[model samples]
Target: MKIAFYGSSLLSSYWNGAATYYRGILRELAGRGHDIVFYEPDAFDRQQHRDIDPPEWARVVVYDATPEALLRVMDEAADADVVVKASGVGVFDDELIEGVMQRAKPHALRIFWDVDAAATLDEMRSAPAHPIRRALPDLDMVLTYGGGQPVVDAYRGFGARECIPIYNALDPTTHHPVEPDPRFACDLAFLGNRLPDREARVEEFFLKAAALSPEKSFLIGGNGWDSKAMPANVRHRGHVYTAEHNAFNCSPLAVLNVARDSMAHIGFSPATRVFEAAGAAACLITDAWEGIELFLKPDEEVLVARDGQDVAAHLAALTPGRARSIGQAALARVRAEHSYALRGEQVDQILRDRSASITHRQQQMERA
Candidate 1:
């Protein structure tokens, strides 16, 4: 299938969380013989900041996202088998969404891939005034990155025709653990951008952990964190490129994961980092969530931390041998069930089933 995507940013993983998710999923799909054209805006110019060149498997088309520019691409959109409007594309102008739907071909599939399903739902639920609130029902499919069950329920409750979770996954060959660098070899570290909604939890989980273990070095990476009043023991490394991520994840004694508000409440939506760290056999101490057991075994593969004390307990008490064993177990689990290959296969299965049903229906109609 030829699929076109409209999302926040692609071509560069520069300080953008969704970029990593897109790279993993789209590249994997391409590896499986699917064609994808990712339509990003020239506004962000993510191409300039790219650590890795865009893959040969997919094409990156930069658009203006204006009604006029979209109309110019109407023929391409109409020719594609699928057109997807992803969440948080930073350029998801209301007008653009409407324009894409208007220009969609008769056979073109439409999808709303909500990487931030929980956050989107929360925003829409609180303020019906938001533009996206009214656009939900018009989407052909509502797919999410996180929010396993609750998010799907919420999307369906909002009258979406179909709701599915694509999830964040690892490409083991790309993410598996390598030798740690001395500079990145901290006791524990959390890597995420400094966003308003996630900062408090970072403090509650990571800062508290740093405070609890004054001797243990804590590392923080990602952009927009210069102003965060981090603890004295915490090391803030502004932003690391996508190429440096695996080294950063594998170097620490254990990587810390702090879920943003949406992920915590909606559950089952593990961040992209979780699978990356797991694939690298890096020990992980994550803030507690409702459906984590489905991904990693608590106390064995992953350690769940509710607060600073919990994080401290895991770091201070966990033996090096036990940590390695747990990380190895977690890596094995991710390889078996949470790789991007797995996600791509699942998507293929769903698309194949849907296509088959459509074909059968058409045949029946012709016979009648």
Candidate 2:
């Protein structure tokens, strides 16, 4: 199958959180003999901070953030077996959604892949004329990186033909245990771009924890946090590139996963960092959210915190041996059950089933 995916940068994790998710799933899909073409707009200085070159597994077309460039990419994607318009492309998102519905060949599978389904669903509900709401009925399927049943049910309520949650998983080849580096060594580290919805949570869960545990070292790595107020024990490394993520994850005695307000409220949406941290055998302490047990075992594989106090308590209680044991357990679990290879196979089956169903329906119409 030839899959044309329109998404945020695949080559850059600068301000885009979905870059690793895209690389993991698409790379696995490509390994299964599918041709993948990724179309990302050159916007938000992402091109200037690319982490990887055009990968061998997928063809990446970086287009200008202009109407003409969008049209050109849309035309190029017309012949694909599957056409995906992902959420948060950061430019011309509505146009791309409409274009997938309007321009793709009738036989092509049209997918609205929502990397941030919780927020997207909220937008659709608030705005009746949202492009995804209008396009839902015509799209063959809606695939989400997270937001399990809540997202599926919400999309169905909006008249989607089908919806599925393809949760984030570890790509062992891309993210795994690496030797700890002194530059990133810390008691706890959190990596996420600064966004309005997530900033408050970051302060509460990360910064507050650091303040409470004054003796422990903490690190923050991501874009847009250079000016954020933090405790003297905390260090901020703005915009750590993807290449250094392994070191960043491995060096920290434990890593943190803070969900955006929408994702936490919606529940069941695991951030990509969770799997990345787990793959690197990093003990993870995550803010409390529903459905985490479905991915990693609580108290054994991961530590769940209800607030900053809980985070501080977890850090205080964690000894080096206990942390190492938890990290290893999480790593083993993800490797056995949540690898991208498993996810890619699930996606392949979904695509095949949907295509066959479409063919069967068409044959019935012909007979009628």
Pick the lDDT winner: 2
- Measured on C-alpha atoms, candidate 1 has an lDDT of 0.82
Give the TM-score (vs. native) of candidate 2.
0.98
lDDT of each: 0.82, 0.92
TM-score, one value per model: 0.94, 0.98
Model 2 over residues 1-368: C-alpha lDDT tens digits?
89999999999988898998999889888988899999999999999999999999999999999999889998976789889999999999989999866888877888999999988988988999998999988999999988878888999999998899999999999899999999999999999989999999999999999999999999999988998878999999988888898999999889999999999998898888999999999999999999999999999999999999999999999999999999999999999999999999999899888878887887898899
Please tell me which predicted candidate would have the highest TM-score against the true structure. Answer: 2
Which 10-residue span in candidate 1 carries the lowest summed lDDT?
Answer: 67-76
**Tens digit of per-residue lDDT, candidate 1, span 202-271:** 9899998899899999999988887888789898898788788889988888999999987898799999
CA error at residue 345 for candidate 1, angstroms: 0.7
Off by over 4 Å in 1: 64-75, 127-131, 359-368
